[model samples]
Target: MDKIERIEIAVIGAGLGGAAAAALLDDAGFVAHTFEQAPGFDRLGAGIHIGPNVMKVFRQIGLEDELARIGSHPSHWFSRDGTTGEYLSEIPLGDYALKEYGAPYITIHRGDMHATQIARLDKSRLHFGFRLSDIVEQDDGVLLTFENGRKVLAGLVIGADGINSVIREKLLGAERPRFSGWIGHRALVDMNKLRSTGLDYERCVKWWWEQSRHIMAYATKSDGSEYYYVTGVPVDSWEHSESFVDSSREEMDAIFGGSHPMVQGLIDATESVTKWPFWNRDPMGLWSRGRLVMLGDACHPMRPHMAQGAGMAIEDAAVLTRCLTMTGVQDYATAFQLYENTRRARATKVQTISNANTWLKDPEDPAWVYAYDPMNVELN
Candidate 1:
C-alpha cells in the first residue's frame, strides 16, 4: 500500500466555492488543504455579480477592496421590457448599497474574480490534478483516494465539488442533476459594434420578454470595456452530451430580433455565444453525514436567474468556517449542524426565488438579500 498522507481538513474542488472555503478556513487558523481534479483553471468567458451579502465574506478574506476595484459598480439593477425598452424596476445599488448593505455591489468577469481568489490561497496546501476516485469512512477520519493514485486521510471533508459532486454521491448515492427545462445563451459582445449603435447601455440591465425569457447584460470590468450577457429561455429538453453547444448571432436574431433598438444592437454586436442547459436538484435532506459535509452547489443547486448562485456558495464557506471555529474540529458534528441550521432557510429561499425567476422584476426592497452579512450572522 502507498503511504497515505494525512491532512487536518480536505476541501474538494478548487472552483470559486471551494477556494473560498479553503481561504476562510485558513483565515480562521485551520489547516485546510484544497484538492482540485483539474490541473489548473483558466480565465473562462463568464461574469458574476457579487452582492454585499457575500462581499462581507470576501472582506474577511481580504478581497473586497481589490474586487471592487476590478469590477463594474452598477448604480442600479434595471429590469426593462424587452421590446418596449421601458424600465419595469430600478433598484438602487451603488452608493445606496454601500450605505445600506454594508458593502459594495459589483459585476465582474468570473475568471478575473476566480483568479484573484486562487492567488490569495496558500499554494503549498493547494494541490491540483488530484481527482477524487474513492472515499472510505474510517474510525478516525475519511480515507480519500485520488485518481492519480495518491491517498489521503482527512479529519473532515468538505464537498465544494459542485452539482456533480462525488462527495454528495457518497452521502446520498449516485443521482444525476435534474434539467430545469431552461437554457442560457452566454456571450461577450463586440464592444466596437455595440458602441457604433450610439445608444448608451446601462451598466446592468435585464431585458425581459414573455414567459420570463430574458437577457441579463452588464459590464464585466471597471473601465466598462468588456460587456457580457446571459439569456434565459424555456426549452423542451437538452439532448446534448457536452456541457454546452456553440451559438451564433443568427440564433440571437432569430429569437430576439426586431425588439428594442438596444436589444437589436446587442444582437448585432454578438461575436461568439454558447448555450448551456441549467441543471438543478431539490434541497437535500442531508448536508453532512459522519465526517463528510457539503457546501455550495453540492448541497443546494439553483438557476442563475437571481445571480446569487456563487454568492450563496461563498456565504456557505463563511458560515461553515465560523461554525467550526465556534465548536472546534473535534466537535465537527455540532459544527456542521450549526452551519446548516444557520444557512438552510436563507439558501432555500434564494433557490426558490431564483427558480421562480421573479427577483427584482418589480420595485421591492432587496434588503434581505443584499444586507446580509455572512461573516457576522449569528450561528445557530
Candidate 2:
C-alpha cells in the first residue's frame, strides 16, 4: 500500500473552485477531498468565457492542450449596440493573450469546462453527495458536519461552496448576499441557426449592450454550438427557482423583447427559459478563521462582466499550494496568513473591476483588468 500521509483538507462545494483547490492540494502531496451538495454533475448554465489567466493555471496543471482542443479560440472581444447593431470597440484576444499573458483566450460551454477539470482530477479524492451542513474550527483542525450526518476533521477547510455558502454562514454568521436586481436568461442554440441569422459566430465574443439590458453570445461546447445570455435589470427579488419557472414569457419578452432581432431570435430558440435574480458578494472582510479559509465565490463573489470568477479560483489554488509548500504546518498561522496576504489584494481587485465593467458603455482601454498576468509571479 502506498503510505498515505494524514494531511487532510476539506474543500466544501465541488464547483470549479472547490475542485481546483482539491486538485492543487493533491498535486502538492496532501490528502485533499471535496464535498459538493449537488448529488452529481449536471450540465447547467450556457457558456462562460475563459480568460488566459485561468488558462495559464491549466498549463501548469498539464491540461491546457486538452482544454484548448475542446474550446473555441476567439481572436478578440467586441462590443456593439443591441438595437442599432453598430460596432463600438474591440480588443485583440488570441496572439496577444499568448504573447503577453502566455496563454490563449477561449470560451467553452460552462458544463464542458467543468467536466474537463473534473475528469483531470483523481476520482478517489472526490466525495460526492457530502453536502455541508455546518462547520466549526477547533484548536487542531476544522470540524465539518455534513447533511449525511457524517463528520469530517481536517487540517484546513476551504469554502469554495459558492455565493450562498453554508460554510460562510457557519464561519461568519448568516448574512444575506446583495441582489444585483438582474434576471439572467441563458441558452445554447444550434450553430446552424446562429449562422443563418447572419451572426458572425467567430471574431471573438460579441456583446450587444443596450440601455437597460445586456445581451452577449458566443460559440461554445466541444463542437461550435453557440450560446446566448440576456440580463434585464431586475425590478424585484425572486424567492426561488420556482418563481423563475413561473415568470411569464410575455413579462420576460417585455424586458428583453425589443432589443434586437438577433437577440430576440436567440431567446426564441430556447425550448424553455429560466430566469433568476443574480446576487454576489463584494470581497468579504475575512477569508480565514482558525484552519478554515474561503476560496473563489465563497470569498469574493463578483459580477461576471470580467469573466474572472473561475480565474480567481485557479489562482487561489496556485497561491494556496505555494503557501503550504513554503510555510509548513509548524507555523500554520503564518502559512494561512501568507495565503491571505498573497491573494486578498488580487482577488479584491478582480471583484471590484468585474463589478465596475458592467457600466462602461465603451471602454477605451481595459484598465484594471487588461494588465493582469498570472504566470509572471511566483510566491516564494
Candidate 3:
C-alpha cells in the first residue's frame, strides 16, 4: 500500500479555510480531522462577501443552495470620496455580477457563513481547542503536538490556521505574520436601524475612500443586518510590525476620529468594536515542504483589500483536493509538489494584489481577483 492510497489528513484551524479544506477532503473519502485552537466557534466582527469564484467552489462542496438561502445578493458596488462622500462610480451586482462571472455574488454575516460550513460537516470530524504547538514531519507521516500535550499523527498535515499559524512555524521556520500597518475596525449593526435612516444598503458594497483611509459597508445575513469594516492605514509601519487585537472601542474611535461622518456614525453604532491588525506574506517559492504542507494564510497571508483572503483559501482547498485525487501518484512528495505547482502562481498573484496599497483604490483596476474559474484553469 502506498502513502497516498489510504491517508489520514490533519488540518489546523477552523476558520473559513480550514473548514473548507476539511469538507473537501471528507467528500473525497480521505480520513480527515480538523484541530481548531479556539475552545469554541465564535463569529467574527461582520459579514464576508463571497464572489462568483468562491461561490462556485461552495457549489462543488454541495452547499450552494444553502449558501444562497442564507446569503444576500447585493445589486451593485459604490465608490465614494472619503472626505465629501461624493459618488465616484458604481458597479452592478446580482444579475450583472452573475452574467459577468457565471455565479452570483453574495454577502452574509461571518457567523452565518460559519454556520453554513458547519451544517455541511459531520460533528465528529472537527476537534475544537486542539491548539497545535509543534509539528514534525517524518518519512512516514507528520506528527502534530498540541499546546495541551495531546498529539495527532497523520499522513498529511495542512496548516489552515490564520495569520498566526503554529504549523507554519514548523514547516517554514519561525516566520511572523507581518503587519500591513493598517488596522481594521469592524462591527455588525441592525438592518432595521439602517433602513429607518434611509441608507441604500443593497445597491452595493459602499466604500468611502480618503487619502489614507477607507470605509466599506454592506447589508448582510438576510438583509436584516449591516456589516461595516473600516481600514485606517498607518503612516509608518513595514512588514512584521506589531499589532493589537481585541482593541477597545475608544481606541477604534481615536483611530477614525476626524474622518467622515458616515464612517463615524457606523463606529458609534457599534458598542463593542474589535480591531484586526492586517498582515500578509510575499509569495514564497515553496508552499509544500514534505508530507507537511501549508494551506490558506499559512501559505500566503494577504490583506483583506480585495476580499480574497477567504476566497483564495477556498480555491486552495479545491485544488488540493484535485491533487489528492490524482491516480497512480503513490509518493506523497510527488503529490505535494504537484499541489504547490498548481497553486503557487495563482496564490502569488492574489497575495501581490492584496499586499498592494489598496487604500489607493484605483478605479482603473477592476478587481480581477474576484474573477477566477477553478474548473477551467489548470493549477499545475
Off by over 4 Å in 3: 1-7, 195-200, 235-261, 364-368
* Candidate 1: Cα lDDT at 165: 97
lDDT: worst 10-residue window of model 2: 1-10
Going through the candidates in the order shown, the clash numbers are: 0, 1, 4
lDDT of 2 at 314: 73
lDDT of 1 by residue, 256-347 (tens): 88887777788788889999999989888999999999999999999998899999999999999999999999999999999999999999
Tens digit per residue, CA lDDT, model 2, 1-22:
2222234787888898887777
Inter-residue clash pairs, candidate 2: 181-234
Under the 3 Å rule for N, CA and C atoms, how many clashes does model 2 have? 1
Where does candidate 2 stray beyond 4 Å?
1-7, 196-200, 241-252, 357-360, 367-380
**What lDDT score is found at residue 363 in candidate 2?**
60
lDDT pick, better of 2 and 3: 3
What is the C-alpha local distance difference test score of candidate 3? 0.74
